[model samples]
Target: MNTSIVGTGVAVPPNVVTNQDLVKIMDTTDEWIRSRTGVRSRRFVDAGTGTSELAAEAALAALADAKLDALSVDAVVCATMTPDRQTPGIAGALAHLVGLSNAVVFDVRQQCAGFLFALDIADMLIATERAATVLVVGAEVHAGYLPWGDAWEIVLGQSTREPSAEERAVATRYRAWSVLFGDGAGAMVLQRGAVHDTAASSGILGSVLHTDGAHANLIEVPGLGSLQRPYADAAQISAGLQHPTMNGSALYRMAVECMPEAVRQVVAKVGLGLADLDLVVAHQANDRILEGVRKRLDVDDAIVPSNIGNWGNTTAATLPILYHELCQTGRVEAGSLVAFTCFGAGAHWGALLYREP
Candidate 1:
């Protein structure tokens, strides 16, 4: 048996923040941001909306695309690093908001590898006969974490007021990262296939995920941790601990080195080679990294598509969102073999393969 992703959908906020927009409030230029991250523009959520709202909307769209009713979903797994609250997770709230009342809901945090993790879990649930239909979602509202400062009025478009020189200095501290992310959600519906199916022609062929926690500190937001006397405090905020710090060189090296290998390893699992792949829906970490993977694998530019120039890095949402957009273009032809890969902050990474019916 196989677990096939039968439907896909994505949702992004209405607001578009261009590289030109970032230059207004930060010590950066359009050329600096684009030449480094390949991002021209990205979506930012309206002031009040959070992760769950975007996830719920994407979930509903996935159900509709699948021609599925919410009641028919047997399980819902949400993957995110950002959530409105801690206790219940976005899965529970998303289930409630999307009417997936009959589904057993939960959440997973695999950083950028999140959607891949969700896909693996859904495959297990379907293969084991535990659930016939599973909805997996990847969403993030990165703006909430971006060092908004007093410039929130400008970033959120609440006011025409310009950020002061002092406000610009504050944002400059994190511009390298803040400019590379956006807010959005993407989801897909996975359904069980017939028991007679063969691995030679099945959905979700296999997934290989890896973690290297020794380097977890390479990317981190320091304020909230169980080891802290208080998970978070004004002191942490005063020290700018709420914003993330990272080792970009190390991450870029890791991605360019690891992803192509993971892709090869995953395809080999199903007795296929890199040449057999028709499309590679990789995580939109950076256009340069994607290019590196493409060049290393020696695949045609058309086979490896990217949306980072438009969406920036929506973290876990990147893969599914890109996949949905590709589907809309009718480029994923029938019987096409697609490969997915992602690497993210916990040093987590993985690659999965699937075949179109």
Candidate 2:
């Protein structure tokens, strides 16, 4: 049997922080951010909000798009690195919020490879007859973990001509993370498609997922997890232990290498080649990384589409959000062969090939 992503939805916080706005609080320039990451602006959440809010909204929207009632959903799987809390998980909380009262609910943290993980799990559930419908979501509230800065005020449309008391309290730190991440959520509904579906039909074709824990340290929040409670005091915060760290050069190299290979593995598994694909939705890590993958695959611009310029990197939300936007454009019509790939903090990477219906 084939699994189909019947509906898709995305929601991003309203506040927009432009590169020009970052210049006031950081040492970077608009040209520098754009040339490096291909991101001109990104959205950040308001002070009191969290990822669950975004996830819930996106989930409901996806259900509506699928023309599915919440009660009909048999499972809710959320993928996120930035869950609102330690217990109950985002998927559990979201199930209640979205009225999937009897559904199996859980969350997975595969970093940027999260949506791919969720898709794989949902597909298996459908294929095994364990579930009739599954709702998968990828959401992030990375902005909350970023060091407080005047950029927050600027993004929120408040006066930051002078740094506010709250902004001044944080001190200048993790400038790169602060400027690169945005808050958003994206979701999709999956169901069993016709058993005889093919690339010429509308359903999933093949998928590949990989992980290398030895390289996990390349991109991580050195301070956030249970082993390290770095948010306890001012000294810890000053040590840069409260936010994520990255070996940029290493990550970029791996992403460029892994993403394309995963794409190829999935394409070949389904009896197709790069040339046969209609669209390639890659992780919104960086514009340069995606470009490297595109060149390595020898595909043209039209096949690989991107939204990193406006949304920055919403982590796990990137792939589904990109797919949702692409669907809206009518560029990926029924029966079109579409592929997606992503690499993130876990040293995790994955790819999926699907046919639209």
Candidate 3:
């Protein structure tokens, strides 16, 4: 049994936060941000909005593209670090929104590597005949969880409210991770059989997934869980553990070093190489990191499509969003070779190789 992507869609918030606009409230300039992260802007959900809202929008579009009713979807796999709440999973909310009453809904919390992991699981489910169609979604709302302050205020701006005293303490202690993250969502539909059967092009050929829990603490939202002692203390609040924390330099090195190898393994497993690939749709975490992997692999720029400058780091939503854009523009044609790769928190990394049918 083989599973292939039949439809794709992405939903970014209507609100766009540009670097120039950010400078009004933060101490940083547009040039500084662009030079450091290649991010000219990013999107954010409106107040009271959450990950499920974005996921539902993207999922519906994908279902429409597949020419299938939402009720036809057999399963809903939501990949995200930010769920609407800490319980029930975003999948259930999305399933309800999309009207998939019979679908088995669940969530995958692999952070940036989430979409890929969800895809892998969906593939297996389809192959095992558990589902004929699976909808996968990745959504995040980092602004809701980001810390704000004089030192870190420039990176986050004043878009969100100030953290409580406890949240502030967490941010202060974890000041090193106060900046450098953004959010959004992306989605795709994977179905059983050939692409033509599903009214799409190709199917997934092979995939690889790896993780190192030893590095889990290197990047994460630390305080919301029960593990923290003196939980919710003002000091913890100031450190930004209530939100996402990233060890920038360390993360950069890990992604650059881990992703290329993962890509190599996947391509080699499929008896292909960089030269054989038509496009590389990777996790849109950082531009410099993408360039590093490209240089290491010696792949041409044209073979890679990046929307990070416009969308920022969407975590699990990155790959599917890029895939949607490429398909819309006809960059990914039938029979084309496309490679997907990702690396993020949990020191997780993986790759999937596909041939458009």
User: Model 2: which ten-residue window has the lowest total lDDT?
Assistant: 165-174
The sequence of per-residue lDDT tens digits that candidate 3 reaches over residues 25-60 is: 445667777777778888777667988999999998
Cα shift from native, residue 219, model 2 (Å): 1.0
Residue-by-residue lDDT tens digits, candidate 1, 216-257? 887888776676779888888889887899889899999887
Off by over 4 Å in 2: 149-151, 164-173, 194-201, 229-235
| lDDT of each residue in 112-197, candidate 2, tens digit only | 89988888989988979999999999999887687755446654558657665555445344565566778899999999985556
In candidate 1, the residue pairs with backbone N, CA or C atoms under 3 Å apart (3 or more residues apart, or in different chains) clash, namely none
State the lDDT at 60 in candidate 1: 90
Local distance difference test, each candidate = 0.88, 0.84, 0.80
Poorest stretch of ten by lDDT in candidate 1: 193-202
Rate residue 159 of model 1 by lDDT: 75
Sort by TM-score, top down from the best: 1, 2, 3
TM-score per model over all chains: 0.97, 0.93, 0.89
